[model samples]
Target chain A: MLDRIRIVLIGTSHPGNIGAAARAMKTMGLSQLAVVAPRCDPRDGEAFARSSGAEDILEAMQQFETLEAAVTDCTLVVGASARSRTLPWPLCSPRELSASLPGELSGSDTGLALVFGREDVGLSNSELQRCHRHVHIPTSEHYSSLNLAAAVQVLAYECRQAWLTTTPVTSPEPFGVEWDNPLASHADTERLFEHLERTLINIGFHDPDNPRQLMARLRRLLLRSRMDSMELNILRGILTRIERHGDPNGNDHPR
Target chain B: MLDRIRIVLIGTSHPGNIGAAARAMKTMGLSQLAVVAPRCDPRDGEAFARSSGAEDILEAMQQFETLEAAVTDCTLVVGASARSRTLPWPLCSPRELSASLPGELSGSDTGLALVFGREDVGLSNSELQRCHRHVHIPTSEHYSSLNLAAAVQVLAYECRQAWLTTTPVTSPEPFGVEWDNPLASHADTERLFEHLERTLINIGFHDPDNPRQLMARLRRLLLRSRMDSMELNILRGILTRIERHGDPNGNDHPR
Candidate 1:
């Protein structure tokens, strides 16, 4: 998967970021490198100095005249940009981008390219539009600007983590005491809500005719609390018993 | 818990970062903010401008002369740093630090403090020592230097998640599935070894007169797996059944 992914740098002014990006890619087991009209020579002494023994990546770098040329053979193109644009293309965080890569590129001959923009001004709206997806690295709202290499490093690292930690079963059960079987179900919740509404009206805490807003808010709060089945059953049982004792009319409750 | 958590920024150079940190804290439902010898005025126009409606956090912020003064009442202090030091103090990742915090500060009068360092050099060795624990955010080796407020946001978010998700239980079960009973108990493990030793001697797997090396290796393997009670009982039951079927003395009749 790493070999199938190519990192494309567009109009990069700093040769050091080119080298750093190579180093970042190599550290995460990625080697394919593409540079599009770099302002400085990638093979320059400064670039090699910052490459930090990642000369193999620098040596194998491919130069292209345009972003489209670099991504010509690529099936899935992800543009790295912090700025949000008016375009309706899918926007992804770095974590989201990493997660989406493997399935998009698996067993396919087409290359997957992650395109980064210029240092001073990031990818223009038109340039970002050429790619299928845009990825943003979340930073502080005060100073969201991230150096090109730093952004590349974050993306590459997340990609490697996503690949290495792919498991047959990824999600863990909810963190708490797990019962062999739930003591209650969705039907129980509805029954409890109705009982609670009656109780609230009896206690004068709710207006009988227009009580939807308060009940909805209470339901949301309970849902967010993540009550286990047994707990829900206990609360519902209490409410049902209360309703039984305090009926104003001689009408039996609906099943 | 949020009120108890005092976010102390030491020698913060950027007013914008201070404001951003406040915003991060507020978003995570933390309110206590402390500034230690900030280089820029926290009330500056730029700071308020960048705060983006988190002006209340800045308005309520406390200014301190020193880091120690800021954290004097704190019972648990966590210092954030990307760099590892030669110090002998306990070091934890952000996850570990988050796990340890809830019990240490909650329900007690003790204050909890999260100290962030200077934007450029980060916390000096002396300043870092004042903290009871240190946290490192996992980042790419290529460029591990994270923006000050970005680091703050990550840590605050993690801390809030930890606090919100903690279930108040007298005894929480270990991670993994909820078993009917543990695979092995502490006492079962101790007894299993004794039974195994006697069986080994009867079968001549261990010398009755002199035995140490082989037994030591076997003990090491058993301890390494952290065998639980149920597993030990099953193994012992199997061993006993095997012994009854086969005897070293070659007895023809059942004893």
Candidate 2:
């Protein structure tokens, strides 16, 4: 389960921070690292220098062009951000986020991605929308400038602490008792959002030209529900049926 | 209470670590930082650069020649160490340490010193002996080389989390139901240890030549009890009486 927990850094400016983040992750027993369109070259010598003995994690790190690509396979995607966001999103402390992991990642195939944003500017609104939940580390009101690697270190430490104390269930318990379906991956959730959006637009219920946080609200609602694979299929099937019913030249191909 | 939590680094070789540590402390609302026998100049350019915006903390940092001098005023002294020691000591996780802080720092005069040792080699046996309790951050078994600043970040983060969640008590409450005396400071505890050791030697109960682990065991016992000032005075008076009774050339000085 620790191996399944990935630390993803997006648009990181400093290679040293990348290296230090790797070191931090390794110290917490998290080996999977992914980078999404980093501003600095993560393979720079400074990265290895800062990595100390965690060069193995750096060497084995996975790089992607976008956050969606980075966390497409992850079942749970959490973004680390400051508390000054104007957008109302699901916010939780690192401790709360970690406490939910035992149940969240109970399935063998269920993986989690802890996403960190750029040093100067945090996750953009679109990038944040992709995350299932946002984690805010409570810093001082006087000084809230937490360094990039330091943020990673704090969250990774929480995850490790939670992992150490939790006893792993030998049999996979799917959140609720006797539920057999695997949790929906990021890709699965994203596809559902797209289908829902298109169906809404076709039915004239949502106007894409003058979108007023409608999709964002729906995304929040669905993400909070944490739909399993079977639930996702049912929702997508409903979306397809709606599209067929609303569209003038639509053929019903829903399974 | 946060300001009273002093982060003490002993024999830190890297100025960058000192700067990063200051940044970490500031993020967690901790302002007091003390360094004992640092190998590198904490005011070096690297430290300031690493501090980012927390230079004020670095500028206001205190320096000391010894750990004793650093934490003499503190009521609680906790050392951060790895778990490979042959000697038995009271060990706790970062969470457990934070959980104890509410009651521990309830007094107006009570302060805590979180001691971190050298980067390469952690706290020495003598340094460990000075601490009332040792905190061990659970890290990966394969790579336990946690960066000094990262360690600071984790502990500081925990302290902040504890602070944020706990409601402050309007009035200070003693540990016991009706205990009126304040907790003993590190200086007071040190004096008690010295007096206890001398009395033991005088009474022929403990030999200085073959000291073994007698002092360490006694220190652990006294530290665990968390004696109040009045309790400390009573114990010291008892030791003085024992010395007078056991010593050949002792003068009677009754308190």
Candidate 3:
């Protein structure tokens, strides 16, 4: 899913940010890079210097004269902007953007583009309007601006998380006995509770009309225990025997 | 919960970083600041100049003779370091560190302390040992080093998020059903579950020999729904009547 997504740098001024962006994309298992009119040479000494070992992405980078040319093949375009734009076109949080990408690009041959603007000016209104969605990087209210590379890193991290979560992962097996299939049945357990309630009523342990806290506490205790079928049956048996012995009249206990 | 977070800087050399740390903390709604063995006076012009209106944090900062003195009152001590240590003592991711704070400090007067080291060299081995846990922020492998102020900002942001999550705020009253006062008690629900299991057995819905997935699914469903006392009673009442009618023979029903 990540491979199908192409990250486009639109009018990027800093060679270091372009390099860093490549590194970020590579870390998150994304490689397709399209540079739209980069001011600095992406393959220059400074660009590769900042790119670290992600020079491969810079080497394979495709240059485009215009943003439209860069994103023409793309089906879903995500524009990265620190500040909100005047025109709205499906504004999404980073989390939502990450989540929506996989489904939108699954099995589709069409490319998905993530466009990042220059550090100083950012994406113009016309530039932002070309994209399907706008993603904002949450920052401190005092200083909402983020370093260009840092923004790329945050977005890349989120994308990786989305990919990992969607993929299957093994988990440890659960402990404890199977509850659904024990010696006792649902019928037996219900009878046991009825008998217990009756016994409580008989012993003046409960006042049904204006019951206080005892029952609630008792319920919490039982829930915490996570009783299995066999165990419940055993308890029920005891209750039934006790009820039979205590009630000779066989009259149903009143609430 | 935000008030309970104590930010401690040990042997800090840069006065600017100290001021910046104060600003970061204030931005995240964290007020407590402690300085231990600072190379420069925290109240110096350089420190105050960079504080950026967070002078109150510097003014209220406590000076400690030793790291031990600073963390003496704290129950949960988190040490921040960029590099891994020789002997790892329960290393925690930033998110884990954030999540663990609330539970560790709940109802306790003891504050949660986050210890940061100098800008040049992080916490010493002995100083790191004083912390109950160590947390490392995820950074690029090429340049994992983060500016001291930047590190503080990231940590403070995470801490603020954790604190807000733990601290319950007033919410709008739930609409529709009185979930808090469900007709059934917890005890009643447990009984219903038991009875339902028995019914399932009789109906061949549950196989005794091999039953794990189904039971787990059922339990998960009930747990997610958050069954209440009143709801439990209503269900139990229905189950009791069904058991009595379905299996009239007392001997056949057993317990």
Best by lDDT: 2
TM-score of model number 2: 0.80
**Candidate 3 Cα misplacement greater than 4 A, ranges:** A1-6, A20-34, A41-49, A52-57, A101-105, A108-112, A167-255, B1-74, B80-88, B98-128, B136-157, B160-255
lDDT of 3 by residue, A172-220 (tens): 1121112243334556655656776775554334568867765655555
Clashing pairs for predicted structure model 1, backbone only: B183-B228, B183-B229, B183-B230, B183-B231, B184-B228, B184-B229, B184-B230, B185-B229
The TM-score obtained for chain B by all candidates, in the order given, is 0.65, 0.65, 0.65
The DockQ value obtained for model 2 is 0.15
* lDDT per residue (tens digit) for residues B92-199 in model 3: 666667666565455334467899998778899767655545677655454454556666776776786566566552331111222345322223434566776675
Comparison by DockQ, 2 against 3, better one: 2
Task: Give the docking tier of candidate 1.
Answer: incorrect
Residue-by-residue lDDT tens digits, candidate 1, A76-175: 8999988877767788876577677678767658668899999889887878989888887665444454557656766776676566556354332332
The better candidate by lDDT, 1 or 2, is 2
The candidate that achieves the highest TM-score relative to the unseen native structure: 2
Q: Candidate 3's interface RMSD, please?
A: 14.5
Per-residue alpha-carbon lDDT of candidate 2 for residues A1-255, written as tens digits (9 for 90 to 100): 688899999999999999999999998999999999999899899999999999999999999999999999998998897854554556777887887777777776889999999998889988888887788887998999999988988888888877886785553343446455677889988988888777665544568999886677567546755677766775575455444533335564222
lDDT of 2: 0.81
lDDT of each: 0.67, 0.81, 0.66
Q: Arrange candidates by lDDT, highest first: which order?
A: 2, 1, 3
